[model samples]
Target chain A: MAGEVKFGILSCANIARTLISAMKLLPEVKIHAIASRSLDKVQSFAAANDVPKETKLYGSYEELLDDDEVDALYVPLPTGLHVEWVLKAAAKKKHILIEKPPAHTVKELDVMLEALQKNGLQYMDGTMWMHHPRTHKMEAVLHDSSTIGRICEVHSTFNYSAEVAYRRKGGLSADVRGNPNLDGLGALGDIGWYCVRGILWAYDYEMPKSVTAHPGASYNEKGVIVSCGATFVWEDGRTATFTTSFNTGHVMKLLVVGVNGSLENDDFVLPARADRAGFKVVSNTSWKDVLGGWNRTEDVQEVTLEIPQEAHMVREFARLVASIRDGSGAVEPRWAEISRKTQVLLDAVKESIENGLKTIDV
Target chain B: MAGEVKFGILSCANIARTLISAMKLLPEVKIHAIASRSLDKVQSFAAANDVPKETKLYGSYEELLDDDEVDALYVPLPTGLHVEWVLKAAAKKKHILIEKPPAHTVKELDVMLEALQKNGLQYMDGTMWMHHPRTHKMEAVLHDSSTIGRICEVHSTFNYSAEVAYRRKGGLSADVRGNPNLDGLGALGDIGWYCVRGILWAYDYEMPKSVTAHPGASYNEKGVIVSCGATFVWEDGRTATFTTSFNTGHVMKLLVVGVNGSLENDDFVLPARADRAGFKVVSNTSWKDVLGGWNRTEDVQEVTLEIPQEAHMVREFARLVASIRDGSGAVEPRWAEISRKTQVLLDAVKESIENGLKTIDV
Candidate 1:
């Protein structure tokens, strides 16, 4: 069904600039089109990101969806507008690579998933870290029982200082994250998405038995959550906790504790040093050495990537699309499974927050 | 009364060996006696650590207490034995420097406190890390609003791989932590004690309004806790979470987040490097640089100590005892306040765990 995978990016959102630029680096994919409601925005974004001259520019999302040249669509629209555009793109029989918080809610995501299934197209959320080589290496260490043993606990936090910019631009009403009509879930959808994904990923996407949101949540004038935290418990006694905020300095951390060892990385969402990514692993530590002295050693392992994580993400998505188009493989269900689990957890946290911090079953 | 502060060792517990050695290094303090029920144990402990020839040796704790030359007693005993011996030491009018878990419960601790008050004795717990100069330096950074701003959240953890040793020594009945009749509160009194103290210390001994213990604690055959975690919330919406265990590899970390910055260290309970102490401070971390680019810089500040932290703890206790004896100053109430708060929080966590993880008010 395919010769080369071509991507059509929907919306000229600022994030789309990075996505398009990363996609341009993948040999398996070509930038096929750029679409927006405003022709000027499409032209400017396409030109600014150095989208290939062969790439078409469409004034409307529907016009790009109707084009036969686009084998897949990358939707980086605002959360509130994702359902409509994602569904339209999926209905056009294009494989979908959608931005995080693929939709505002699980119900909206379900509709998009159904369209992708009915049209026989592939789908994966654009979580760049997942495709990083460092991530894979860390995963190996975590699952290696001899080194890490069974995972006992995990703690992840994703926070950023975004409020100052919102205030400088005008006020809460003018802020996309602060506006209830735009990104209604605010920090929960924006930053908490990564946190929930991290916890689920650590446990191989095993759903938690229950999730209890911690009581206090900071909200904007529009009544959207800007900061929150939660604790989760699995059936077999494993536990995970996470905090997400827009009120603190930027910090992205993930710590996984095991019986024999632990893995920790502060810049889990984004590599700390862009050229190389690293994580610390300390295994089989003892207060006293076998020869009778204290021994404390930790190995900091780094994985250098020729391509940045964002580009690796684009390459992986392109490869998956290529496989499906060439009748080589079926869409990977793991991606959708984790994405749904993340939303389920997010929904439970929101539910717990709304209902006086009750424990909600995942 | 204060020519040189004299200290009596209550028992030849493994920890006493370290405390006595630290005490020997302090010129202002004299090791007056070493005591244990077994004469062989006391003699070997005293000689192995090179107690001075003038230091008295006692075959029983009672003989040590009766020694008129010993001005103070260092009680490094099991949790269940603390209340009985602490009250006994106080009744003899000896100033006290006790190890962690001063008593099994807060009520027991209150009785010991009453004894100290009745006997006009100076008291301090052997929480060595508290006496480290590095701790005070980090405290300054946390309290400095211009740099770190207001403390909003804290995450502290203290865990060690003690299970292998426990098993090697022959299972639950032989393990003090596993025997409910000995260290009754188990991991809560052992590791969780330090985690709770770290959180309380970070907030200047302010008690949390509520504490909810996380479920799924691992226990030995005797049903004593081995691993557990909890979430705490203050009246002002400041939050803290902690996890403590004997099942995992050693990890002692404390991360304090502020509005403008954060202070983090992995060796809060024990310095990672004994010769020097360090903590990372990331202050005034705006999302962008002053010139408008991403800027993330963390400064590692280290404070070198002429004496180890344990020596500093002994020296501090001796100073307090000296002040009491020479009419220089009364005992510092601050140490007792923080110790009591730590016990209260520990009691609350135990209560929550016993009550099936109910949210308990402190």
Candidate 2:
């Protein structure tokens, strides 16, 4: 790996696995250290994985946060624990990649964002699917003016079988998703946030001025709310509505309907989707992207889609780390900002659902 | 038009004009007479349209309703007036096609249904687009099973531009669209009802168990409601969410996304959109009646679609009339029950919105 960026990960969580696998495939990055709360746990993880800096056991999270060799911190804790760790990492001057649902509420997110800027630390939100090359291709294809029509409405959805939708040890219910105190926010926070973020990314992403929702009512055995929905309105008079449910079956999709035509896609469960005769441009994001399905007669065009063997998030993260170390520009800096806004909107929606879905000023 | 069905309209309104133009397109039907409360209006309309038999004139709606010569009724009056006319037409044993937002509440809808059955009268809700050729193609593509995946979720939207949405002078909003006294229901009934009806048409008549909504508090300057929304769950575990706005710039859309792929279309509007890949199809509804899109797709294997002309609605309406006389199976008869159910669900939603969105029994 020439001119490589040395990276150290602090957990053996799913997100850690995603990052490590991607690191394995890239030449511009190297795994330097593996840390865990227990020395034995860290040693086993390091043994199966390649890390030049060996296994470092930290009985306390503070030890890892204070380690100077760790140029960036990857926090994949529960949604409830994000702010506490993000601020701790920011204080140590480490660049951060916090997993989705960056915080339980915007107030918590505000604290984390404030700390990042105050410490002059570079930061990014780890909303994985956003980094996919398909997203870039969609953005470009949708912006193809030759096809005609501005997108007037965006309809995004992702439903799941209620049983499989439940949290690690629980059943599917609104309490699991709606209780900000328990799940930090439910369906939208976990995956739907990505759907909404995808819409913003595909569009120029001007924030909506007003948001209100009619979310499904979810309840745990003890009776707590866990499911709901929210709609937002943009200034130029476009509207975006989203639904996140733990009680429904598998759905991972985002649809952007334009006046002239429409485009859509899904990640994790489904690939990119769009009207075949409208437009299909080359992938724009630095990841594997594919596009094809056209009608040459009516001037409709398409491009062949390509998917890299590795996950898109991993690819983008490695590049981001390398850019920082080499003093180069960010690979996709807007991702972090989009993630922030997505989080903020999700937080407001939670409030709207909790307080009778009142229209909130975005 | 020898021995053919003679169509005599009961209003001088826009929808009546549409029906008149539509009947003109149907060789099996003829606009024999038009009755209004004002003879001057009738004479002017008759003279301008060159009708050989305008039935002179009628100063009262009952005179028109009791006319032995008129076989069926197409009631496109104020929303508040739908129930009364439906009951009268049914009692008279006239096959009836009433404008949507059939009644202001579920109780009214139930009574209307009961009346139609009690009198052995055939009935149809004028959701003409459900029978559009392109809609038929869209349905076929959705159920193609070969391309579309398991149905995930459906998001249906129908909005008309504020300035162009309603009855201007003695318009329906003040007389029918949103006035509980006239329109009988708000956004859901006036336009959103079609979305609900479309879903039933798309999903082979699968019905949701419970419904909920969060209606906007927006009102036109003259006190007409301009927007509202609802989210419903089917007993089979599928979920549906819909929105209808009269204040926004005009737009109408219907989207069905499945596990492997999806179906996208704006069948009501010209330049009808069709289908896209990677979107799933969960509905049991066959593509037997699916509509085609504007231009054909080059990759016809996965991207099939149908486009229709504006007269599509005219042709569909004529089918309803032919179905009653020629018995062509009642113009998608199953939709009548769905429309009644939709009205009930809408009533419950309105009650919920007024009471902080409390969940109501279906």
The candidate scoring highest on DockQ is 1
Query: If you superpose only chain B onto the true chain B, what TM-score does each candidate give?
Result: 0.95, 0.80
How much DockQ does model 2 earn? 0.10
* TM-score of candidate 2 relative to the true fold: 0.69
Q: State how far residue B192 of model 1 sits from its true place (Å).
A: 1.3
The C-alpha TM-scores of every prediction are 0.94, 0.69
The whole-model C-alpha lDDT of candidate 2 against the native structure comes to 0.59
All models: lDDT?
Answer: 0.82, 0.59
Indicate which candidate wins on lDDT. 1
DockQ of 1: 0.40
What tens-digit string does per-residue lDDT give for candidate 2 at A1-362?
A: 45665555656654566566656656665665555777787666656655444445564567787777777776666677777777878888777777677777777887888898777566677765555455555567678754324665665665544444334545454333445564556666776676677667656777888777664545455443334566777776667777765544344556565544445443322332311212332111111111111221122244333333233555566667667667785445565577678877887776776776577888
